[model samples]
Target: MKGAERIEIDRRYCKGCMLCQYVCKYEVFEVGQERSALDYLMPRAAKLENCRVCRLCESHCPDMALVVVAKKKGKGKE
Candidate 1:
């Protein structure tokens, strides 16, 4: 697999559960100081390159606020 392109945490729906941090095996997420729309502290993608696109965080998120977009393969060449 090409791995992850980006990791998105929808602030509008996110409840700052930190499930993404708990589930990320690569330690991609960090404890963020920024508060969301709901006034809950959010998690930030601190080490994006370390992610393997496992989607464990996305599935574990209770609010369905996390989205991990995988990098597409074979655009033209390697």
Candidate 2:
């Protein structure tokens, strides 16, 4: 199965619309208490392991604040 390396949320531009959370099928995000520079509630990557590298959250982000980094591919058993 594909896995994600990390999920990044740019706090500076995030409007906290939470479209990423709504689009995510893996439930990788949660409502966080932390506020962004825009003074909106930011979502936290609570369940990193749940992410399947689908990039749904990234595409759904209106502010383009969410970034999903997929695990690097390795050349093995070639």
Candidate 3:
């Protein structure tokens, strides 16, 4: 949680729907100008620092295009 983790989106399955953004309370996503493999402009993760690793966006994605990675734990603190 100290650093940001990357979020992967599969454009082939994404439908350009913003439900992931709508469901994210952290405001981690934004509507992007890039077109998807589905030939539609898809939403992008514009603010990853705001993400809480809540997995809400992954669960809310209708086509399951979103994948979130949690940061790796550092040395023996856990």
Candidate 4:
């Protein structure tokens, strides 16, 4: 799981809605004080180490504020 992709949240579009955190079975997200452009608290990737590269948050975000990027492996070892 160490080399898996990470999930990122866009603070600008976030509305303090914890749907992303709620939908994550791996508990990869948490509420943070970072205010959004809309003046609302936002959630953050607090437990990225537990993420399994699942795109549940991306598909569940109503504001389209979540992004799950698949980390690219360097070099040509594949």
Who wins the lDDT comparison? Answer: 2
TM values, all candidates:
0.87, 0.88, 0.87, 0.81
For TM-score, the strongest prediction is: 2
Per-residue lDDT tens digits for candidate 2, residues 1-78, read 677898899999899888888999989989999999999999998999999988989998888898889888777721
Off by over 4 Å in 3: 2-4, 76-78
Residues 4-60, model 3: lDDT tens digits: 488888988989889999999889889999888979888888999888888988998
For each candidate, the alpha-carbon lDDT, in order, equals: 0.89, 0.89, 0.86, 0.81
After aligning candidate 1 to the native by TM-score, how far in Å is the CA of 2 from where it should be? 3.0
Candidate 2 backbone collisions, by pair: none
lDDT of 4 by residue, 45-73 (tens): 88787877778888999999988887776
RMSD (Cα, Å) of model 3: 1.8
lDDT of 1 by residue, 1-78 (tens): 447889888889889989889988889999898888999999999998898887899999999998999888877845
Measured on C-alpha atoms, candidate 3 has an lDDT of: 0.86
- Candidate 1: segments with Cα more than 4 A from true spot: 75-78
